[model samples]
Target chain A: MDKVGLEKHTSKQFDADLEDVRELVLAMGGLVEQQIADAVRALITGEGALGEEVVQGDTEVNRMEVEIDEECTRILARRAPQAGDLRLIIAVAKTITDLERIGDEAEKIGRMSTHLASYDRPKSAFYQIEMLGRHVREMLRDALDAFARLDSEAALRVAQQDEDVDREYEGIVRQCITYMMEDPRTIRHMLDVLWAVKALERIGDHSTNISEYVVYFVEGKDVRHIGLEAMEKEINEGAARRRGD
Target chain B: MDKVGLEKHTSKQFDADLEDVRELVLAMGGLVEQQIADAVRALITGEGALGEEVVQGDTEVNRMEVEIDEECTRILARRAPQAGDLRLIIAVAKTITDLERIGDEAEKIGRMSTHLASYDRPKSAFYQIEMLGRHVREMLRDALDAFARLDSEAALRVAQQDEDVDREYEGIVRQCITYMMEDPRTIRHMLDVLWAVKALERIGDHSTNISEYVVYFVEGKDVRHIGLEAMEKEINEGAARRRGD
Candidate 1:
């Protein structure tokens, strides 16, 4: 909000840089999110080749992360932007780190997928786990869109969606335990499911992180550590509520 | 290394402010590290009351994080520290965020321990998990010390030790699966151990983050996303040994 020195410049350069950074960030987010989806799909479908592809795809995400970092540094050094522009660059840097870690987690999931493909005995319930993966991927895309648009309301919505993914994770864990108890043969398969579920839950968390950064960049407020339920309750009570009953 | 504007007395004020920020960050690190240890102890010893204590202790960590943020903001507003001091503040701010999250994760583990204590289930064989917790705790403490001292050597050592903790975590997961298969009733207990072990592994990750920050703050080199095993190997193959072996 504090334009300071930035106001003197024509709006074209400012908008262009902002658009460029957002485009790069969203592109990075898309790749990382797809990687997560493919990684989980490889697990459920027993596609070892797909799993290997997800693992290899992480290199591109990592490379993009470095390029984004360099771009951010260059912007800061050259323009010396203040306040909102500063926050935007900072958010881009931090969110890219989160996105890269999401890529790493996705790669880990892919390796687990490869291992699960090799297991002689497979867990019977793959559909539910894939649903959970879809839930996480949707949340990630929503969070990334919210960040690019600087939509605080959209960001809060994504944060609310995290709880659903969390519940799905809990359900998967319970089901895995149930499966392992029914027969000892399901041990390795269930364990791999557990790891995969954990990775998806972590992806939800990172998406929430990107949302938090969005709120910070847009509003200049740190809303972290606040209880999500309380936040939703406040939003529902406030004029921000749109459709949900 | 480039002190671009050190001719004026304002630079001295910035340096002093940076020193204060560093001191506060170290203090916060000490408190968070203690919270981690206390949480692990509560889990291992089944100290429900201590678990409650650990959860309550997180408020202090949160307060310290806010204080650190305010201090950084004030320094940026007043002195506008450039180069190394600017990087140091940013690194400290990022480190505290990770540390606070570590505290929150530890609190979650504590809460899980309390839940485990309430359930009438067979106890898990947490020997490997306990070792993993110890390794993570030491890595965290050492990494913070390295940050405070700006000792890349010490940070590298802590980074190298993370692999040991990770290996121990794998061992615990395997052991948990073995227990769950031997008796279906052990599934709940095994899940508890799994959650705790995962928390410890995340703690190890945060230590790695702190070490990376040390590398950045000391060397001004972002060694993040580099292969940890390769870095450890390079570090361990000492200067003299590098020529011969």
Candidate 2:
């Protein structure tokens, strides 16, 4: 083939590979989000079958994670990419790990659901768990969208949303303690709920991690654990400068 | 200078930079280990002053982490190193983050110790808390040693030791619950101890993370969360094959 044809073919191959990886990541994210939603729903609705499916489905997420990792390794070895391309590969690699862990957390919630469902009537705090799940699910979606678009602002927002999940987790824990104190029989069962809620909170943390990766990929900086207020202030100041405020 | 001389000079410069980074990591590790020791000692002796010192000294570890990160960034930008050099830089960058978090956990323990010291006779299983601290402190040191020498075997061992720390933490929490039930007055104080012990367990997790990074740097593969039994089986099989057994 002519040099121009060769160059064209190589760029086409690169684009195809990038798209393949993007699809894999989005698929993995979708599966993880589904897992979290189903796990929480299973607990709230006492659906044993749904909980079992979430638990069993985690193996598939784990398998996809290994495959994605292998693909990233192969791309890095063969493409010798630099700068933005390198950042994209690293982001996908790191995000997949976070996604897989989120899957595990969902599985944990599912397993706990099987145990907690046996309770005669769950403490009213099931509503809090459901709300926490909704918040984290939204964060996961936003984080993934930010990653797909390389949007730093969206990623920052997702990170900010994590605090709400954390606060809800705290409230649930306090409520569980009150129930445990009211009746000793509630101790073992309530502890399971506590663990499950803790796992869900950690899932929110992993979503924050995904957002941090999005920020890293887009800005080439680590903005993790820095308060959302500071992040918003900086971003708002930059926008104000652009608008001559 | 001739091409050969220039190449030799550049190589020496790379080696020197690598050593500088390595030495800094070791210094950070030493401080982290000392912080763990001081935190434990404060707990055992009820030394409020020592606990305060540990909390105050954590600022140094955080500053060191930033310095190490900056150094790694400069090396990567200036040298554009490959393979082993790349791994060394990446390991240092990641290990410092783990070390800094370890420092934070130790400070948390220190703060808890101050509060516990004020309480009249720590009613819970103080012994189990001490045991948890000892096991985690040992894990932290062994992880640092493994990383310093790039010893994959040592890293694997450190990962295995984490399970021991986890079991100790479980014991402490169980004992705390019993104490809280016996005397409601001790409830809040015992909960604080539980949180501090949980922090130590988390610090052990950070040590596991460091050990996993060491393994990755040395072997170019991730084996995190893989059981020690599986690692032992792999090693035994490799040994048998080498001996033509």
Candidate 3:
């Protein structure tokens, strides 16, 4: 083949490899999102069986993470991709780690849900947990979607959503404190609620992490270790530049 | 210059670059270790000023993380290092991330210490936190030492230590629950302790992550997503095989 033919072949192969990584990542994200939703439902409905399913489902997420990581390493070793391609590989690798941890957090919630199912619960605390869970699940969904689309604007929106989740989490913690203070008998069950909310809060954090990776992948910038306000400003400026283009 | 001389020069340059990255990582590790120590001291002593210093020190850790990451990327792009060199770079990049997160967790403990300083004391709770914090700090130190020496065995030892930290964390949580149940007024103060222990537990996790990276760098294996029992078994088998040689 001529020089152009060989160049085209190499580029095509790199594209195909990247596409494979993306598909695997999306599949893992979809599984994790379901795990979060099912875990929350199990918590609210007091269904231990569904919670068990979420816990069992985590093994698959873990497997997907390992597979995706291996693929990224293989590409990096074989192709020695540079610039945008290197950034994408790094982002995908880091994103899967976050996804796997999200799955683990969901599994923790599932376990807590199973434990809580055996106890007589507080109605208001359960309601707050359900609401917080819904918010975090939405954030995860949006973060994954932004990653799939390479949409920094959508990613920034998801990052901003974390503050709302944090607020809701604080509210739940305060309510749990009140419940425990009013009736010591409820302390044991309230502890479970507290732990579940902590897991939900962590899920929100992992989602924000995913959004940060999306920004990094798209812009090749490291926005981490900076304040949220600075991150938001950077994302907004990137969006404006895209519009100007 | 001849081809042989050029190859020799390139190898020397690569070694120098690797050494530089390693030195930066160790320096960052030292800063993080100090942060953890200071944060724990502040938590136990109820010195808000020390906590503020730890929080402020996180900026330096963050800057180091970014600089190290950029250096890794530059080396990858310019050197196209392979095999062990490639794995070492990847491990350093990933390890620095976990170290930065450990710093963030320390900063969180610092902030909680600042807040809890304003509250009335729970003597026994503080004691338990102190014990747990010391264990986790030791684990961080061992993990960093393992990385610096490229000692996979030491890394495995550090990974094993995380279980003890987890058990200690659970004990602290249980004590906090009991305190909250016994005295309604102490519930608020106890919650602060709970969050700090939670942060400490997370720091242990990040420490485990660094250890796993050490194992990966040495053995070229992925031991994560697997249970600790399995990881220990793998490391032991590897050790046994080495002995047979």
Candidate 4:
């Protein structure tokens, strides 16, 4: 429930700069989340134009990343941010990189959707993909919420969803491979589906990365590469101490 | 011809810290490069043991990334570095992320190699994978060299190799799809090879990121997502102006 304390700085402009950058990140995240949903919907519904739109929108995403990066560097140079502010800047840098990558993956899915548009919709696998897409979109949303609120506990919860997404991805891949074996004619379409699914799995990973950054920004800990249980334990222990305080 | 100019710092300890970090990044790069080679070799040669070793060694790579990250953060906090020093710290942070990702790709290749070991060596596609692996490995090595020497020009050259790697990867994927159609019995093995090749392609991408980081470090320009030719033009213009200087 702790929000990022934006009003602590004596310099109101510094607080405004941080707030503006934060809003920009959330806007970027919202756009990326929509892209993932649209790309997945395009794939399932065989909407080629929607897919193309998603691809075109990626340029905007790239532009935002560059703009935000420059803003961060400017803040760093002018402010020489320390302590929590420095961690916030670093975390913002890492978060935007993951968001931009999520945009790229969504664009890939969009391309795959256009290709899949030419083929008959494979109902069963497409359903699984839709489900996976929904899972990751929620994960993305919740991670951004955690970031906005400085909710390390919520971020930890979001991080755990990654395992479920990964398992679902594997099951889908196995099913798709089985389809390829049974019907040789479906190889091209199935492979496209597999690639699209792979992109979804990677989106899940980037979501996990964003949540980790939330923890890093809030807790001032580098929780990357650590296993889920350990991350959870560390976050929970920190929460206990904070509650005691 | 330009080094990172570590000697510019007023504090001798700050200069020494920068030099130490630079060396640490190079050492990490060296380990990652070897991991890529061993992983690819294990895939091509069906050395499951070697693949396992590569997979196990990833923890060490992850450890290096974490250690280097802490060091960079410490330097940033302590030095409050300005201009080139700030850029160097930021670029180092970004570079370690890419290198860590390259290591992750290598580990995935290792896993795929272990999976691919059960089947007979499919010579043709495996050769393509090997060549593609070597191509990316070179890109990575050249990128690290660019970082060490602050050679933006060399970095641009390394960036160009990514396209060739991408083309080769596509060629391999297409050929593998043909193989899967010709013989469904080879589906599992061919898919494993395809995944490994995908890993190789991603390694190329990470290499390109590193090269871009080098360019950023040397020229103080954000050249990413700008396309290969545009990046070259910008770097060339920088070099041209520097020559006049």
Candidate 5:
């Protein structure tokens, strides 16, 4: 991990800028994590007000994204950061985009929560949705923690957790389908749950994306588009090489 | 329009690099457009082989994305592009991401096509799916064209087209629900159609994302996270200001 420490630039101001960007990213990550939690709670508890609050909070997330993007662009233009510094900026830029998107997905879930609150409680379906949401929220938290620590291994673990979330999401979908088929009257409500589950699935993907960016920032490798198996292998080999050094 | 032209850097090699990236982006765009067409055609025609081919071709699109991304990073590090040049690089980076994800969504649709082909054809549902696919494919094509020409107005039109796609998507979902409720045996097949429609809806979103990138590249304004109405207003104002200039 020490070998992968942040590269020090000659200029102190450039270093300060880099640190500032990381803090902002973490701040944004914290807000997103909260949004996910609130959205999920709103869904399970049928608390429309909490869901509405999550929806309103997304605007702040969007504003932070723009601010971070501008800062990254300014740094690129002014400092002309090389190698690791450049990768950090690129990773931060990409990460915030995913975070903002995650916020949007959470807002979608929040809106669905509001709508579902008006309907009869689908207790069994709510359990699965809550379970999947918890898994995704944990993955997101681990991804941010990985980024904060620049721990590629932690990032890899976070990426792996996505599979579990995906499985859970599929289970929820199947359950929703069963519920819908059992009673035609519950079709619309079940569809809402399905969409909410889909949103959670997407959030898992965005979390995987953020983890990929963390690997790229630290390892300077592009792990995207490659299958997960290959990515895992690459990350493991990189870890071994670091150990050898 | 001249006001939005690419900025000249002091280094000629930098100009060459920018042109090279644009060409690669256009190349990737062309491949993605074909993928969308082929995937949809497979869905409509029930040509499983065609869908499989589209799935296989995604590797090429993925390769191009990595190549273009590396080029952008290299140029940013070596040239330290400023102002419009910086924005162009950022936009290209963001655009390629959306393009790649669009390819993934198309692949998902292609996979669904293969699965649905094996199942009995849901003829009526296929009609709506085919129509929505055609509209989304066109929007994607127009989005790529707008990027190629740096045509902001064309990009705005592409963005606006997404609403129609969304409306059609909702209609298809409703139809699928009705089909499922009327016959429980068809629920599984209709779910497949529903998933395919969801993929198409997502493709529209990625297309809209690309269009927003184009507007950002040309107008130097970030239109993302802003509602479509605000985006339209902003683009119109930018166009008006350009006219005054």
Candidate 6:
């Protein structure tokens, strides 16, 4: 092939490589989202066997993280991509770490669910775990959607949910302690519920982390560890400047 | 200056940048280690005041992580380093993340310690949390030691300790359940101890992740998620081949 044609072909290939990894990330996210849903369902429905399935499902999420990471490393080494491409690679690298940890949290919930199965309950999810679980699941789904669309504004909105989740988490902890203190018979059961709730709280944090990476990818900004208000102000300001607002 | 001299001069500067970032990672690691120690001590000594200090100390660890991350990103964008240099930068980027998370776990323990303070304990670390905390602390220190020396061998050893930590964590969980079951009043306090032990277990996981990054840096192998046995065999075999053994 002529030099121009060869150059164009290589660029096309690089785009394809990037696209492939992006799809893989969404797939991984979908799997993780399911894991959380299933694990929480198991906890609520008293389906101990389903909890085991969720535990096994983690292997796939872990596999996806490693696979996505290797692809990013390969692209970085071979393409030496600069600017936006480099940031995408870095953000994907960071995002998958959060996703993997989120998977770990899901697995922990799954394990707890299995243990909670034997402890007879109302055959419905605890009110607190259900509430926290629903909020966290939504956050994870929206976080992945934002990444897929490269939507920084949506990422910010989703991240704001974390504060509510934290409040819910704290509420549950206090409530659990009250229950355990009132009746020692419920101590074992309440403790298990608390563990499930703790895992849900962590999943919320990881979802927030995923949202931060989306903003990082789209805006070329690192908003991590910064307070939510500051993160919001800077991103909005940057957007305003770009729009000549 | 001549072209060759200019090339050499730029290379020297690149090396210095890499060295600077490496030093920063160790500094960050040292700070995280101290946070864990202080947090655990607070729990054991019933020093609620110290626990608050440990929680506040986490802000410094978070700041160091962001600073280190920015430096690494600057190097990557400007240097466009290849092969070993690129690996070093990427590994540093990843290592600080685990260190930051280890700091988070310490902060969690700190928070739990503060809560446990009011419950009136024996003025000694609960035997379970104390034992588990000591083991995890050693692992963090050794993981940092391995990173400093680029000693994958040491990293492998430290990573292996994670299993023992896991077993100890399980033991403590069982023991805590027994204590809470037998004595109703101890439920609240034992639950707090459980949270502290849970945080220590996660710290072990984060320390193992740091060790995995060290292995990645030295061997250019991504040993994460692979069982420890596989990680050990590959690293040892690679060492043997390098030595023509």
Candidate achieving the largest TM-score: 4
DockQ of each: 0.46, 0.20, 0.63, 0.78, 0.73, 0.53
Candidate 1 at A210: error in angstroms? 1.0
Q: Determine the TM-score of chain B of model 5.
A: 0.95
lDDT of 4 by residue, B107-157 (tens): 999999899887787688888888998999999999998999899989999
What TM value does model 6 have?
0.92
TM-score of every candidate: 0.87, 0.81, 0.93, 0.98, 0.95, 0.92
Mark the 10 consecutive residues where model 4 chain A has the least summed lDDT.
Answer: A1-10
* Candidate 5 wrong stretches, greater than 4 Å: A1-3, B1-3
Could you tell me which residue pairs clash in candidate 4? none
Worst 10 residues of 1 chain B by lDDT: B1-10
B165-212, model 2: which lDDT tens digit per residue? 888888877876776676655655765676688789989988998987
Give the fraction of reference interface contacts each candidate recovers. 0.46, 0.00, 0.63, 0.69, 0.71, 0.57
Docking class of 1: acceptable
Off by over 4 Å in 3: A1-10, A236-245, B1-10, B240-244
TM-score of chain A, all candidates: 0.87, 0.90, 0.93, 0.97, 0.96, 0.93
The clash numbers for all candidates, in the given order, read: 0, 0, 0, 0, 0, 0
Task: Give the winner by TM-score: 1 or 3.
Answer: 3
Tens-digit lDDT string for candidate 3 (A24-44): 999999999999999999999
DockQ of 4: 0.78
Candidate 5 residues B173-214, lDDT tens each?
A: 988888878887777677777887899999999999999999
lDDT score, candidate 5, position B153: 85
lDDT of 3 at B45: 89
Tens digits of lDDT, candidate 1, B77-184: 555555666667667877887888888889888887887765553344555666777888889889988887776668888887877888888877887777777877
lDDT for each residue of candidate 6 in A1-245, tens digit (9 for 90 to 100): 00001012357889888888889999999999999999999998779999999999898998999899889888877887777788888889999999999999899899989998877763233766787899999999999988888878889988899999999998888887777777778877777888889999999999999999988877778898888998898678767766778
Model 1 spans with C-alpha error above 4 angstroms: A1-15, A118-124, A229-245, B1-9, B118-124, B228-245
Model 6 agreement with the true structure over B96-133: per-residue lDDT tens digits: 99999999989988988899877766433376678888
Off by over 4 Å in 2: A1-19, A47-57, A64-66, A73-80, A233-245, B1-10, B41-104, B107-117, B121-124, B233-245
